[model samples]
Target chain A: MFELQAPLIARREVASGMWVLSFSAPEVAATARAGQFVNLLLRPGPLLRRPFSVYRATSGVVEVLLKPVGAGTAGLAALALGESVSLLGPLGSGFQLDQAAGSVALVSGGLGVAPMPLAARAAAALGLQVHWVHGARTAAELCSEWEGRRVHWATDDGSIGYHGSVLAAIPEGIGQVVACGPNRMLAALAARFPRAQVAIETYMGCGTGVCLGCAVPRTSGVYDRACKEGPVYQANDIRWDVLPQHLHYGLGA
Target chain B: MSGLRVGGVELRSPVLAASGTFGYGTEVPLCDRPRLGGMVSKGIFLQPRPGTPPPRIVETPSGMLNAIGLQGPGVEALIRDYCPLWAEWDFPVLVNINGESVDEYAELAARLDGVPGVSGLEINISCPNVREGGMFFGKDPAQAAAVTAAVRRSTRLPVWVKLTPAVSDLAEVARACESAGADALCAINTLVGMSFDLGTGRPRLAFGTGGLSGPAIRPIAVHLAHQAAQSVAIPVIGIGGIGGAEDALEFLYAGCQAVQIGTATFIDPNAIGKTMEALEALDWRRLVEGTRAAISSG
Candidate 1:
């Protein structure tokens, strides 16, 4: 909930158009959880703040992964070393993992892998066996592997591990599943598994939950704000059918 | 720093956080809640509104377009859940009221009358009047006057009518509200606008059209504030795209009694606090002497 001018500590391109940025935000790094996000203020012209999931946090530093999809993110990607950026976070409810579960699965598609690295580290700390399943259009888009963890990959063009959707690569007998990505992939995951927690992506204003702009329909017939009630929700709690068709794919980040 | 007296309430500073941007002023940590002049809460309605579906907001150059549809928890929930918290804060809290009809506006004012922790009312006439075939109350001076008069009669609290920038004659509407017993005038609300997605060949926002706010609208807002201040006898609270002390000075030089910080809060959560700091650093003595010299030279 604190706003700070965090100086860029490190910036590296992990994929073709994707990057990982680390910032020196001690307070946010200290308090941020696995599923929460940070809203980065872009250049003045585009007034809307861009929200990015917390990729990693350790010892007075926090990292966020982003792809240059539009003007807001492109502005972020263009920042130089030692530049100070305005950051408002750590925001929204992140993935809630069950401590009692013996085994867990982390499913990610496309840029959805932004939040999984931290989730993988957290699940390992909780004494649960973690499995990572990742998918993209090609092998170059797949994120680099997490050290000392079992990782599975899927590519649509048959250039990687499995020649199908990442949903097909997930093994059975997983006690719990956590996912993040485009809505269509999330919908498929929700339909296939009953015990799944998903982090949703939507258009938001004032990421602090005051504007009520980021709304997702719930199974209970009420719209819940994705900023406050969650960017993360239990799979069955969402009413996916009522969501707009354009939102089903890769539009929102 | 000197304070501002609007209607019956006295504020610590003249820079207040605008409605819909600052939330309840509870979660903002760096904002220095007690030092703020005042804060307007989010728009409240007779019943809870679900608001428009996603994409409710979109970026448009130096501004943003949003059609949040005034989503709120209704009047009863505000009284039950948030008023107790407001009562604890040292600063005054003005409730922004929105309604579907003249009667609904009056009823909402009546319900808030004499309520503890409630400092005043700022009527949001920008919403569509369901009884009038979806025409907005603020768009027409006569309808705006009627709504203001109804609320003025219903409550003893100080009333400030929030006017829209989309109207043709903003001064006419300002005068109309002043004639109907409004204590002050808050000028101006967001300009009605829209944006389209080029790739998808559709409107960027789900509602198709929305209200635009930010630095892009500042010059237009200053022009309207100047007009409204000239036309009305009541104090004018200037709003729309105020980011820093310089922007606020434009409204003050234009004759506004106070200014409200809106879209800037989205950029920095402590924008109000920062603006207050910047204002305190200014030499008022020099500014007054300069103004006097200019007037004499002319």
Candidate 2:
């Protein structure tokens, strides 16, 4: 892990309220894995650092996809080109692929798609056939697409491929699954696919396992910090029933 | 730039990472550990605590509110799991011990007294004295003194009593701890405060209220440190909203021998290291002389 000031290289509004921000952070980009994240400082106010999953990492740059839901994220979205942001990463546990599985399904919902593209690329590099299942509230919110792949889509309204949810769009014969989305959606995926490794999100303090603020209760009765023990965990390891119900996603309604 | 002598222990730097914020001092691999003077581990209780529920933290205008409820793996687990690693570090590792009663406090101190990895103990008297009906020990001078005395008797290690700003007369509490045998004093734990979420028609944090820390509380902390330093002879280690060398300088000018970087670690995990670097670049003799000159002129 490294803490460095990353200069903004590019920014793109991928969806209605979502943005894909690229930064020049060679050290972080060099060490970051598929599911690891970076914690960015929101300055001038709100002393707490906000955590963003690595959307993509290339030669000497890292990208983070975020939706401006609160003041911290809004500050990030408002950053101009060439501006610098303090980044602490590549942090937390990333996705662990099963080498034995010939194929895998990558699932995401809303801004959860932040980590999917990289995960897909990583899984594809391992010679595993990758299937993408992504969903959002609407088409405008769909946010991303992978070129030259068998991609599936779901939306709350009938304007998308699947009329209901992404959970229903998971095709059969996939030996492994990796998902990131709302707690409810992740829980449903866990219930349907016991082998799913789902990325969990929670409010964090230190993001280094010190504060114990972002603890997610596990099936064995021990609390695991999403920032430390995992931002990713196997389906059976989590106790979804006890997980907090309401989360402030920060996307303005 | 130079080390500080706090009671029997000698810290390599004057900037110690405050408890709760620094974790066990081993979690952040990215941080440069040797740059820190020392680090106080998270609060350790007699029994394990699950801490508060989700939304345990909320951002304020210039700081943040957090009611982590002292979540920890209990003293036994800490000693068993982390002591060996701490023992190997170049810097000191002070355990911040918390309890509900004086006896419990003494027991924890006694247990850590001769432990190889442990350097000292910071008695967290800000916790409620449950036997006395939820009154914070730090809020009552008499109770604070009694707890300090008991812990002092139980351990040979240097004891630093952590004070809370919620009390009316912080000087009296500092004096009480000193008289009862505290080696040093940590002025100002997080000030008890709360924030409301107007949109949800409810409190922002799940625990309703939390300890407020960061730049917003710096002035208040400085005032309290000044008062506590004036009222006691023991070394005062200042804490609360200390983000950089400038902030640490305020406490030092107020008579604090050392300062702990707390909330700033949330903003920059390498805050303590950076503050130490900043302090190294400063002319301390001039800063101190200037402050003294201003005081004398006034």
Tens-place lDDT per residue, model 1, A128-227, is: 8999998998989888745236788899998989999999999888889999888888888899985599998887777887676787888887787788
C-alpha RMSD by candidate, in order: 2.5, 2.4
Model 2: how far residue B100 lies from native, Å: 1.5
lDDT of candidate 2 over A199-225, digit per residue (tens): 988888778777777878889887768
Pairs of residues clashing in candidate 2:
A69-A250
Worst 10 residues of 2 chain B by lDDT: B126-135
CAPRI accuracy category, model 1: medium
Q: Model 2 misses residue A45 by how many Å?
A: 4.9
Top-lDDT structure, candidate number: 2
C-alpha lDDT score of every prediction, in listed order: 0.83, 0.84
List TM-scores of chain B, every candidate: 0.94, 0.94
**Model 2, stretches more than 4 Å misplaced?**
A249-253, B1-3, B127-135, B293-298
Residue pairs that clash (backbone atoms under 3 angstroms), model 1? A35-A94
Which of the CAPRI classes, incorrect, acceptable, medium or high, describes model 2? medium
